[model samples]
Target: MAHAQDASLVARDDIPKTFDDVIPGGQDFTRKEVMIPMRDGTKLFTVIIIPKGAKDAPMILTRTPYNAGERAGNPKAMTIGDAVPLADAAFVEAGYIRVYQDVRGKYGSEGKYIMMYPPRGPLNPTKTDETTDGWDTIDWLVKHIPESNGRVGMIGSSYEGETVAMALLDPHPALKAAVPESPMIDTYMGDDWFHYGAFRQMMLGYVHMQTVQKGAGAVTPTDTYDKYEEYLRAGSVGDYIRSRGLEKLPFVARMMAHPAYDSFWQGQDLARLMAAKPSNVPTLWEQGLFDQEDMWGANHAWLALKAAGHAANNWLVMGPWSHSQVNGKGYNVGPFKWEGDTARFYNRQMVLPFFEQYLRDGQPAKLARVNIYNTGDDRWDAFDDWPTSCAKGCGTALTPLYLSKGASLAFDKPADAQAADTYVSDPAKPVPFLPRPVLDPFFGYGTDFAGYIPWSSWLLHDQRFVDGRSDVLTYETPVLTSAVRVQGTPKVDLRAMTTGTDGDFVVKLIDVFPPSVPSDPAMGGYQMAIAMDILRGRYRESFEHPTAIPANTPQAYAFELPNVNHVFKPGHRIMVQVQSTLFPLYDRNPQTFVPNIFNAKPGDYQPATITVLRSDSQPSAVWLPVVGKSTTP
Candidate 1:
């Protein structure tokens, strides 16, 4: 029976200490749990990890509700109860048979938790979510485990990176290969409960104070328990959702009571359910250019699997950690650092030689379809795609800098009888992603933390910690003699007009440096470093259709901005700030779109009117994709 469950988990004694000390190749292999089933009969609940007296090997799945037995165990734990176990050790010592599971309803599985996945709406040829329970747990671990070898590969990260893109839909014909780290594909554009349309609100109120007010197994520890108790569960999910009043199970109130994009997140659209065809297996994507929240679902699932011509073998690996910050062990990052052997060069050269060239015996591994990690010159570059035509640019061109009055970033443009910059977002005085009593360096647990928190120049060199906030709005762009690279995703064309009936806009792109000549005890001087992105403006014209911009008249309101490479140097200065609110990185838009603001009501609140057009015939810009020159090798 699967070789006596791998010979009674190698005569267990809790073989812990991570399979008895940092698994190099401990007793060949063994560790069980198993349950499998699926196709709606539901069972799931795996663990696997095999190899022991090998028979076939090469089966590496993951599927997680965060607890695939705490990723096989040993995710580094120093103290605070010390338990660190997480297996799948570099794809089980590069030989294979990893497994993991749990996904169905989470822990010890059975069913009924649906936190996210194909259970939000439409698409029902008759039931079962998470891609038909990942094609029935890869068709019963490729026809009943026994050292599996039917060639399969999958990995994890956030929600086990959306269960490796929901097992790349229509999967399991013996799967083949997959990776997924930092995944989401679509939690309504701007993954994980919203951003750039706002509604992330204090990391979904710290993910409902670590999942449903610390009830389901007391505050965040599922994904199969054991990320070595993340810094002693740090602020234990805002102290157990403020001691059980439950703060209304906030996931930004289920993403602002569904601002359109109905089917409640379109039935967990992981890139239109791993977009049809082109996935003949072979895929690997790991993202995090400071993961500002699931980095646009791993850049829209690596550009929709290279525009659906998939044929497997596609790879990607962005870094600077967070959201699992380069997997455990105080991964600091940013401000200018790197040396931890680049996080063990992805477990001794790209995840155990990509499971020894596709589950052993089938050798090939010449990797790198893109292996980014250039936090503006920190190093590690290798691409065949992702902006690497030497980092192509030249499309976004919107340049209007505007916003004038005091905080500047001109190209002129403002005075058409200008006035707005107001600011009074009193969702009880929010605006913190670090920037108080000096706090610059952060990377790991960002998107404002719940997971993925890495590389944070404190939202780019502290503009006076969001300029004495009234609801934020600052702009700058002076120095610079030459050097302005950028890269992609910029959009900001907002010819706005709102008196209420829906409102929000948060764009922030900063770069403005020149402060650490010994200054930077956390922003006392100049140091703005996030030359990246922040976008959010109410489903900005179709995240499934959110419509609503009447009241005062004028319209057109875009804000994309999230792909960046950075080079704006010369003297540095290219800022672009706009605001409505970023407090809690989102979730304050209550200019009125009610139904749930934790029982809102201040008379349902209202008092909005924010425009920033820039006319010359309605010119409103900020485009700038610019990349251009590159001979650097």
Candidate 2:
């Protein structure tokens, strides 16, 4: 059997990793490719799609790490509609020139690829950064593409959206408008990589999908069907990644090196960076109320710019969609419906008009400073500003929905002397984020709901699945007699203690539908979470510092959940779910304090008794942004 040199004997690691380009059909537009050179001599591959008879047209560009070819569709296909992403269809029809570029070191671009590509400074030794690249590309487009009207705007979702936000930091004169839809802003604080300091290990698959190769290489599917079983079997996310050799990726290794929210992560925070260098670029920050990946990006960026005095030109639009769902058909999320093709309506009414005003030098339309979609009643709400409870309040109050005795949620402060709920957080039986048979996030959860909704609306999943779990502690109000509205970020004032030295806390604000519905009778007693978040125990005091908690110590864990524009209709109940682990969604905290969780030993994984204190001295409650104190008992 000495056949080591045999051609047929292929090593498992030597197997080819092929990536397929999944793009829409070909289109009738004039498509062309160019290698636009940057100041550093790196040539970024760009795809330009000019509409039929285009002349003096404003350009709408999307700079993406994902292959531009994949985003621009096949060149050999048929109609104009088939040329670009569905989100660009409206702009294309409106006679806008569509352009897509592969960021440096991705696809046909030439340069070293760094995830997020930190801005040019001490962190980035070389001169080139995302901002420089954006400026260079825009300069090239205005000079070379004679068909362009010398006016350009940036628009994209997800990673592409992040690029747009990056460009705004050092915007070119031609860069008139920007629309960052569901952009990933910060990794460790609030965005994809981690929530507070709890590592979102579930997103490890995304590392392979993005960073394995130059093009978007397909992530190898797990041997096991359920990710829960796979992740659980590996013990730790670090173990799983190390076992697969994924830790070798630069970004992965860098992420592992800095578990704390140190300079490595903070240096790239878009919101913070934008605050330092506030731009006058007219920005329309689009956020999906239930965006699974990037609920924090656009919101924080909007707030930072406003607070930094770059307020007037900055606008916000939060819709009742999930992660970039506004780019696709958005009639509904989960079992809820929004009457019409809401995505189409948004593109036509808001996007097209907004771009027309800034890019095309057209009449400025009347757009609200902060336009949001109300979930409970399914209507859009326009406001002059946000958080309605800020400085000059807008009838919004920080109403504390206190966790009370006997598993009740109350508007009044808890008067109980020693009312507390205790549960054993066994790592061996960590609760699942969604019901078991949790699938891979790499494959994606499209907007589809047959028997179950395994898509972007995962947050909107019914809380009833984990309602009875011993580890999960749920508190709810009695059936509401009147509608209650929550219109901003809900702060969690968690008074908790753990038997172990380390722990995690997940909080959810849910709106429980009535037990029975008249018109949609099948849709009864659904517990949809309006806002949810998690915080790692060590980062309780400072996100930048990690400290060990004294065993059996009562500590306060405070954090803000993402923005919400939800209402609790009459007959419905308000709910608050408290738990230690989100399971595979976030990595196990291991309970025992260790120097590094990545290198935690098996013995570190201990079962801890978690207590939610509801006493008058240590009252646990979620501060809701109640619109009017209108809820009736």
Give the alpha-carbon lDDT of every model: 0.58, 0.87
- Candidate 1 residue 414 Cα shift, in angstroms, is 13
Model 2, runs deviating above 4 Å:
1-28, 390-395, 444-453
Q: Over the stretch 377-441, how does candidate 2's per-residue lDDT look in tens digits?
A: 78889998898852234555688889998899888888878879999999889988888778777
Which candidate wins on lDDT?
2
- Compute each candidate's TM-score over C-alphas: 0.34, 0.93
> Ten consecutive residues with minimal summed lDDT in candidate 2?
444-453
lDDT of 1 at 346: 67
Q: Which is the leading candidate under TM-score?
A: 2
TM-score of 1: 0.34
Judged by whole-model lDDT over C-alpha atoms, candidate 1 comes out at 0.58
